[model samples]
Target: MLAFPRPASSAFYRPDIDGLRAIAVLSVIAYHIGVPGLPGGFVGVDIFFVLSGFLISGLLRQELLATGSLGFAAFFARRIRRLGPALMLVTLVTLLAGYMVLLPDAANTLGREARAVVTLSANHHFMKHAFDYFNTATDLKPLLHTWSLAVEEQYYLLWPLLMLGAYRAGGGEKALRPTLLAVLLLSFAACLSLSYSDMPKAFYLMPARAWEFAAGGLLAWLPLRHSRSAWHANALAGGGLAILLCSIVLLDEHSMVFPGWVVLLPVCGTLLVLAAGGLDPHHAPGRLLGSRWFTALGLLSYSWYLWHQPLLALGRYYDVGQRDLLRDFLLGGVLALFLAWLTYCLVEQPVRQRRWRCFATDKSTLWAGLAMSVLVWLVASAAMYMPKKYPWPGYQAILQVKQDQAQLPPGCDMPERGVPLSPQASCRIGPAHAPLQLLAWGDSHTDHAMPMYQLLAQAQGVGILRRAYHGCPPLVDAVPVGEGKVRSWCLNHSRAVMAELASLSRSGLHGVLMNVRWNGYTALPVAGSASITGLAQADAQGNVAVAGAMLAGVGQLDRAHSLQVMAASLDRVASQLAALRLKLVLLAPEPEMPLSVPECLARRGAAACHASRADVDRQRAAILPILQQVASRHANVRVWDPIARFCDAQTCYAAAAGVVRYQDQNHLTASMSRTLQADFAPLFSWARQP
Candidate 1:
């Protein structure tokens, strides 16, 4: 057996650990800032989890081995000193920034999140509110990054107690090894299970995350034997680092369910590096990690993590230039580094090092920490309720847009589960006595475009039947499955709706106005839980599993494959409708804005509240071709492009005539949708006649 060096017994600073810290923080920053070729940069938080477990467990193990007991108060005091001051400082600054730059709704959110940060409950708060960490909307939240810190703190609260219990259970430090191993196994099992079942719980809760810490804690107890050669140690550390690099390269936000099976790569990698270096800091990995630059960045990692997100998010919120994302992040990074240095030097170093005798002891540190936390909490509470009192310029206009944003009238859209295809009285959009001539079919996009349909129905004196299942596109064989909670209902609803199309045609329904967000269905699938509308292919016997093939154990279909599947489905559906003498009018996709129009207007005002026409065109480049090809194939099928109505040559304006045009990123507001009657007149006239 190759002898691996045992860790040194005596306590000493490990520069290599600092280097590792530097790597973790930088990876996170790079990921958040949209750094290219580093989509898996989020794995940095998992790395931090392991590092914290190892260091904290090692410290407790050392104390138990020497003194046979733990000093709970002293440990917590040290932690408070290390974490509290810098957090309070950042929260205060973020709060002031919120007050100055944000609208009432956004300011209130910042205030609420600020309280959660100071109270160390940010993980729970964000878990409830922010469903997906990778969601684009979450990029606007400055305090969102604090959830990881909350997880670490929550783990520390229970970990030392477990260590103390294990120490008292006999066999001295050896007892801790088994206890940590048990925790590692059990917590990992729970994490794996919940990642599939309840992702938010798995992601944000400490229980599901405890295994990562336990893996690090187990590293602290690994028995080491001194070896003559360093080659094996170098190989082990190199292999570990190679694994981490692979993870960073291969994984992304939607690559896999986060902190699931894939997380083991980073956890194992971190363990390998720490295991090899803990015994001898002279190993190749150690020497590289302990270099001056790595150590310096490591020293500033905590403060940098705290400062960067707020600066970036606030910068985005206040930005009017609509500059390139890379440029925005680059500028934000410089500002964040400067602020982090000031925070580290002015607040973190002074408090943690106990520069004055009065603040030197554990008691003083705890009291000061408590006072600071209270101050933050009070200020956050004030900011929460104070937003309405201080209105910004054009606040009333923004407020009206916020209050009166468009939605499909109640009872019109399908519920999450089960197929409810029957239309109610409210679902018909025309004079009650007028004959129902048209079917408005699609997903949420159709729901958003209802006002235009309603206006046309009333003007043309024809009833339009509204049939919309949220997230389920208008397709026959392509069923939406995987990821979202609504998938089950979507499949059932889609199947039922498609099956009823012939019945509708027999009952005098003449045309189908199909308008869905085509980009979502056609986008390439990554290796994650992002559900897509999949094409169900049949086996040899002409047998098809409406719920089986493509959805069972299959992730989303790739972009080209998905588009192919959708085009085939559209062809079949259009052909079927054409044979039934039903006119098929395919509404070309509306330009999707980069952000919520109302939210953008409230924050950046009217001048800056629009998306680049070039960017919109780029987004739709893949979608338009398939739609055009599908529409051109059938005599009765035609495509209607509304790009000219909503957009000029240069821009797709979010608001027009001081009214917000979009309710969110893609969906049009009722006011804006109503203004599109001129655009929809020809289609409505044709459908009514047919």
Candidate 2:
């Protein structure tokens, strides 16, 4: 119930719309702060899109009806005044903070993103870099939230031109609705087509998102505000509130394919509320939204949106030791709100309200905005190249961590992205002239353990032919079901590896060493972490097209069935190796850490970089029995568990005795990988036998 002064507004201005803005911004911040039970709070951006379309399109329609033409310069100037100043301030402050505290490489990335922000192309930049909006890694990127702003800016660029064209072609504002309808339908079609097939494209690109704006614009041209019956308006408003609440509660990031048909629920819900005149003082929703506190929050919404993400991301980037998410959220929230209020009073209101002499005229305001943008671009350019020009603090430690990455011989490393795996290809890790004794194969887990395999190969005086794919497990006819190249590559790669094993058995290969990220592939998403599930298929080209719907609603029964399939696949491989008289060593799942060892070591001691043993046990519980059962079925097959080597009674350590053990959350560094020679020696001894 805080009282605030009213700002100047036209007749069309709805205080309830500002209340809606408050809801959108607050929900987004809550989602980013890891707020429980609001996983789909991201739909708040959809709400903003609708609001923008309604407001902007209504203003343009009014201009066209009165003047019989659009004033392009005035429209663009108003846009620059509203959006540019706050963005520039935020980008500048973010750059300074990033340069002060972030790692050199991270600072340089921030600088590049800053430049992209000023140029209003951050969406394209992030899309090119393949930044997954839903990934946990986004928590470290201070400017990742700017992608939505870029989408809005890009929409502004094209939408006005389209409106002008329709006004001139059809004579005044009459043709505006049909034009918006055409855009809405076409953009929605594109959104549906790409949501499952090309998720990143659908998420970051404006063309796929324009339908949201168009939905709002169509509402502007409709006769919603002139409704005579109060009862009818009340019913529509109630229904819309119910729908919005349902959309927010039901949808979550891990499973939902967004911006598709499912998006219609929120968009239409918002339309209903607007159409019912939710700002009318008579209605409950309207009264709640138009109240003093909500409108005040709505007034500060833009600046809050600009401030919150940077504070949250920067806090995470620099945090050390024991982490408390709720404490951090509260601290960051207080700081962001304080800064947002300051910026609203000092920067946003001045530039937007035309209080300054430089902004007194539209033309002058546009020029001043241009000058501010240039300043940001130049400063950001310096930030981008400064790390390369001068050595940063802790340079040597950063270099060492970079060098600690797994060393695969040339032509042997699996592509992290693009380029499907070739089943016919294999890399030798020992001397070229040595006989092939062990075949090392699996996913990236096999790649991480290669240093140990290499030491064993040289000590045994034998060669190991290694084959690995980034995300593919060595399971017959079981392909990961999802978007991207991984699905298309896994099945074909597995078949090729199986064929190569058959050929190698005839060529005197003595043993096969295998390692896969068993928990990653077998476990369902838990604690907001994404997990992979495999679908059964037999296509040679891995062209098995499984719909996302086929994988949805997978219960415990489905998981049990999947585990049975995985065990059968492992048994089939073991049977093939047993018949060939070759020993099969199945490596158990490596202990995965919650934090990067090198990142943790850079600021804290080794003691703080360990994972809880109970957590690891829970993660691996489902997959271990299947591995053991498969090994028990064949005399030549043996399962080697690394839990004893990597863990004590209570914790699994990420580093030991001054040496970092892991490169990232799940992959072992080469330095640590080489230290496991003893564990691998027995396998090499068996491989070298007869």
TM-score of each: 0.75, 0.85
Q: What's the CA error at residue 274 for candidate 1, in Å?
A: 2.5
Candidate 1, residues 1-690: lDDT per residue as tens digits? 112212223457788888888889888888888888999988989889999988988888888889999998899888988888888888999998888777788899999999998889999998877766776556678899999999999989998888888888756876888888888889999998877666667888999999999898888878765446797678778888888888777787564676678889999999988877855568888899888888777878888899888887877776521335665576457778777777777777777668855359988877887888899999999888787787565567656665564445567656656466655576777888988889888888887878888888888888888888766777656654333222455556666776676787787788988888876665433111133434443233323344212322244455666667778888888888888889988888888776567767766676666778998888778778877887788888888899998789999888878557886667787788888889789877887565
Candidate 2: pairs in clash: none
Position 93, candidate 2: lDDT: 92
On the 0 to 100 scale, the lDDT of residue 335 in model 2 is: 79
lDDT of each: 0.76, 0.76
Alpha-carbon RMSD, each predicted model: 7.1, 4.2
